[model samples]
Target: MSVETVGIIGIAALFALMAFRTPVAFAMLLVGFFGTWILGGFRSSGAVLITETYGAVSNYSLVVVPMFILLGNIASAAGFSRSLYDAAYAWVGGFRGGLASASVIGCAAFSAVSGSSVATAVTIGKVALPEMKRLGYSASLSTGSIAAGGTLGFLIPPSTGFALYAVLTEESIGRLFMAGILPGILMMGLFMAAISIVTWLDPKAGPHGDHVRFLQKLKLLGKAAPLLAVMVLSIGGIYVGAFTPVEASGIGAALVILIALAMRALTLSAFYEALLDTVKTTAMLFTIVIGANVLNPFLAMTHIPETLGTALTTLGLGPYGSLAVIILAYVALGMFLDGLSMLVVTIPIVFPIIKAAGFDPIWFGVVAVIVIEMGMITPPVGLNVFVVKGVAEDVPMSAIFRGVMPFLMAMIIGLLLIIAFPQIALLIPNSMFG
Candidate 1:
């Protein structure tokens, strides 16, 4: 068989393995190794494998992954996520559908700390769901809000999604983090607006809870202040050039650990567990990254990216039109693939197309993340929906899907706004970096 044909078959086999529930790391590794062997001799393939594996894992920038994950895990162990939710609840829990709105804000805040959509959904769902239920909020709205809000983990600064994207594309992680800030806040606002509209149309779905006095609100704010400070010092420090992404992540993790110890919120066992969790998550991320690195060289040998980019360019679709198609494919794939898997699998193929079409890689990163966020709430494999379902056992799966639809619409609108104004994603990064 021809070398290009081997690459084609390898791509097909990769998808088949994934469809059968093989892990992405394993699938990519297997396909990439053998495909390279088919084209080049065993010696070349083996050398490529060793080189990519070592290079991927040994990358200094990858240290940010574990540090940020540790920061998130420590924050969770310290009960900072709960404090974030409580503070948001105190301020916004009195408005019509206010609890739901607060859930969105809480998710956004915790996402800055947690950086994983599943962690954000699970943490905030545990805190927010019961209260919404107690307040007689509908299961759909309560669960839907939490599930949708969890997506913020992908879009907010310190986000694992963006970190992985940066590593894959060789973009500056700090710039990508800065790029995410405004878009994240804009999407959070759109989510709140969705809640308001839902409650305005059906007040029974989101009845107001007990109002907090001004002093109590201040107290709640104080409780959440440490996390806010950590977020500011880490993410904000990066923006102002005080720290690189890695330093910010290290300092953030250390600061959160100190704060947790100070508050007596984290037991020794809990701290140990947080460290273990960080190690495990970091290991998983790096394995997939290594696998992707192996596959990338194999794909390059086949000229698949060049071929596809030429094919798409030949189609006469304008830049925006071509982008729409790529995004639509992301949305479709998101139904079955997790965000990280989707990103790693497709970026090698689509990134060349994106650049050929004249889109900024940073802007495209934000756009890709938003589409991936949509998938987190999409059906069949909406990971966040499943996380929220585990927390809200009483809420039916279908009902959770139903609840997520409106917020899904909100996500779509936020995406459209960003597309119409690329500056929404670029303003902070450009101003700071330039």
Candidate 2:
């Protein structure tokens, strides 16, 4: 059989494996391995799998993943995440739907360090949900805000989503990191706006939080300052070229550890748990990377990406029209696949089409991340929604999905604005690099 025909069959097998509930990593690895064996000799396929596994695990840039994950886990264990939320609440809690706004702001701040939506949602949801409930905030507004806001973890700097995107596309991680800043801020503001509208339409849905004195606010900010400082030192250092991503990540992790120990907030048991959690999360991410690497070569040999790119360019839809189709495809896939799996599996196919159509790759990275973020709140397979449900066990899952709808609308608006003005994603990166 021809190699291209084998590639087509491999693609079919991939979807079949996924449909049968095989883990995405193993599915990709299996398809890539056996397809290559079928096309080439057994020896070559074995060599590909072994070498790619080692290379993915040992990659220097990927060290940023674990360090950042460790930094976030330690902060959560140490109660810094609570401090961050408290600070936001102190300042914003008095406004209508203020606690929900604070939840979003809290998620964005935490995203600067954590970089995982599940972690962001869990940490903030654990702290925010009960308080919102006590303050009489509606379940939909309370849970929805955090579920949507947690998505900031994927769009903000030090994001695992962006890190994996960089690895897949060979884009500059630093540039992508910088690129995400304004868009992240934009999305956060939009989320807050959605909160305002929700409460404005139905005042009782989110009652005003207790008024915090200016002195108390100052004290809360003081408690939150250490995290802000660490974020500035690490993410800020990358922006100024004062450190590589690896250096920034290492420094961030070490700083968080020292701060936690110095503050006496982290017990040895908690620290041990943080380390173990980091290791498990890091291992899962690494496996996904390895699987993608294994699968990519088989796909390349089949020339599927090239063929898809050619087909896209010849469609005469024009660039923006074509982009709409790609975005739609992402939205559809988001309902079924988790964000990371969607990113790794699809970028190899969509990226070439994007490049051929003349969009800036870094800008597209921001666009792709934003669209995937929406999926975190999108129903049927809304990962963040499920994560939030774990924290608010009493809230019906349907209510959680209902709650995210406003924020989901907010995401669409934010995405449209970014598309209309690409500089929202590119401004910082261009200014810093140029």
Residues 104-207, model 1: lDDT tens digits:
99999988877888888988898999999999999899999999999999999889999889988999898899999999999999999999999888999999
The weakest ten consecutive residues by lDDT in model 2 span: 305-314
**Regions of model 1 farther than 4 Å from truth:** none
Stretches off by above 4 angstroms in model 2 are none
Per-residue C-alpha lDDT of model 2 across residues 264-288, encoded as one tens digit per residue: 9999999999999999999999999
Query: CA shift at 158, candidate 2, in angstroms?
Result: 1.0
C-alpha lDDT (0 to 100) for residue 2 of candidate 1:
68
Q: What's the C-alpha lDDT at position 57 in model 2?
A: 88
Q: What is the lDDT of residue 247 in candidate 2?
A: 96
The pairs that clash in candidate 1 are none
TM-score of 2: 0.98
